[model samples]
Target: MEFKEVVGRRRSIRFFEPDKPVEREKIQVILETARLASCAVNAHWLRAIVVDRDKIPPDKLNQLKTPVAALTLDLAPVHIYFFCDLGVVKRIKGSRLRELVDAGALAPTHGWSHKFVDEFVYPQILEPMTNNLQGYLAAAMADCGGAAQNALLAAFDEGLGACLNTPNPVLTKQVFDVPDDWVSLWVMLVGYPAESWEAGGQRPRPPFEELYYEGDINTPFKRDPGVVEKLKASKMITAPAPLPGRRQEILQLAERLNLPM
Candidate 1:
């Protein structure tokens, strides 16, 4: 599938064909894409548990879901639990910078050594993340989001439906035999689509002019109309008009779910 189409069609798929199984090989490929996601200095402090519907006991799977996630998890063919591997930050040089050095992007004489990482990076970055719990949690969530999005796009490329979600963190962690440091981040529900794969028409977004800054906070930056038009024409960018009744439909669904509108 085209990259633009993949972006457009990538919706938070809720309904899935429960009985349909996503192949293990396909899951491996999606995970490879996830491994390639950018993170903090390529610390690679992340891992995942790819749970199949039939493999886990029903009671345990139920524990992983909250009120918001139950419907989605109930029907998903697979549930991928993304988490932070606290030990990665303990490494003197994380996987990424070493790989960069090996690729000749860094001169051996120019960059700091693993000893420097031990002396400085740990004291300045990793230590604070632990001593300051909020910082640690925020970094974990952001890192997992980056990795999960890569997997989601890869799943889309494989013609499978995937959705990113946050389940009840405590319950989810309990279900898996995670270490004290292996903190739960979020989940990605995967399977064959049970509904239309279309984007449900273009969704609403903040006005483009309001989204970005020109220099500082005061001035809003607008994209050049000619460039924007060209991108739209090539199907690389789209901002379709909203369909009528969409907001009301959303409100109804929220009401059904007992969620604040």
Candidate 2:
């Protein structure tokens, strides 16, 4: 599929084919594409754990209610958890001197030690500016979003359905044996979508004039009608999916997708 259609057609598909299983390699490809996303300090702050339908014990899946309102934990066959690797920032900071030298930013001829960064540079300059515990994890949350977005796109491209989920961190930790240092951010539910992958003609977006700004914050940018038409024709922008019937279908399936009481 064209990248434009892939993005435009992507939906938070909650209903998946219950009998179908996702290929192991497809999950890997989606994750690998996600890991390439850029983040703070080149630290690669995100790490992921892929849990197939079988990996997580049945009792563990039962502990989830919504994870987010309306998300059914067991509906999708695969769950990919995007988490903060707490040690990433420190690892990046510790390797700073060596990386700088290798990149030719600093000369090996310069008298630099861990003490230089540890005592002088880090304390006065780097420490205040760089990762503190609260700040580091906070930044990681932002970093993980990019990686997650990549995963979404990758899953769509691979003809899989996926949704981002907020699972209960406490229950998740118990289920996955998550390390104390790792933060459970969000999970991606991946599997075969039950409905049409085509746009459902329901795009809940603000008007472009309301969404985009001009030279000043107070001013809205007026988009040209011709340009908008051109974009629509090119699949660069999607029209609302064919409607009327679409909403009911989504609602009905959404109800069915919910876990049994």
Candidate 3:
């Protein structure tokens, strides 16, 4: 699809053909797209559970309806749980390590090495109580968000419709039996859109001038008229190009994930 068309068509698809099954291969394709999403210093910490009948909680599944709308979860062919893992940041080189080791600041040692891990890092990270809880949570949340958006757009590219939502986090934790260390960030329903009534036209977006900034938020950036016109005229609404090797990387990752039985 053209970029503009994809943008115009990519709506928060709520109504779907409930009976139809979204193929495993297609779902794989969407996930592959998400795998390519950008991250902060490649702190890849998001984990997703593509739940079908067996793993999904019965009671929670029964209550998955919105107030006025139809049962959104039941309508889709598949439901996905997006989770944020707190450990990824701990494994990577992040700001916390930098702050501790920078020359001016209180340094952990001469350099960040395995020796440092044995002396300073091991005692600090191994003890569950001593971890940087807040810092880890913040990094994990950001990583999860990037992965979520990747999944959403990948669905769009696959000619599938999807709705992303935040389910009751507490209930989700209990129902899915998620570990205390991992948090449920959100859920997304995926399937082909039902051909029914129009979901009132595409929602509004603040004119680019309002939302975007130049060097800072204080100064509104002016996009070139020709460039804007070209974008507006040609294709779907897209962000910038993702980093190279994203799709390939994600496909390799899918092999490691637990797919529905």
The most accurate candidate by TM-score is: 1
Question: Quick one: best lDDT, which candidate?
Answer: 1
lDDT of 1 at 197: 64
Could you estimate the TM-score for every candidate?
0.82, 0.80, 0.69
Q: How would you encode candidate 2's per-residue C-alpha lDDT over 132-223 as one tens digit per residue?
A: 66775667788888899989999988999988878787877677787787887887889998866753754677888888899987898988
User: Higher TM-score: candidate 1 or 3?
Assistant: 1
For model 3, where is the 10-residue window of minimal lDDT?
Answer: 252-261
Candidate 1 overall Cα lDDT vs. reference? 0.76
The positional error of residue 209 in candidate 1, measured at the CA in angstroms, is 1.9
**Could you give candidate 1's per-residue lDDT for residues 85-152 as a string of tens digits?**
76666554444555665676545588655655556665776666666767776786688778888899
Candidate 1: give the clashing pairs. none
- Report the lDDT of model 1 for residue 10: 73
Clashing pairs in 3: 3-235, 3-236, 4-235, 4-236
Backbone Cα, N, C clashes tallied per candidate: 0, 5, 4
RMSD of 2: 4.2
How close to the true structure is residue 153 of candidate 1, measured as C-alpha lDDT?
Answer: 90
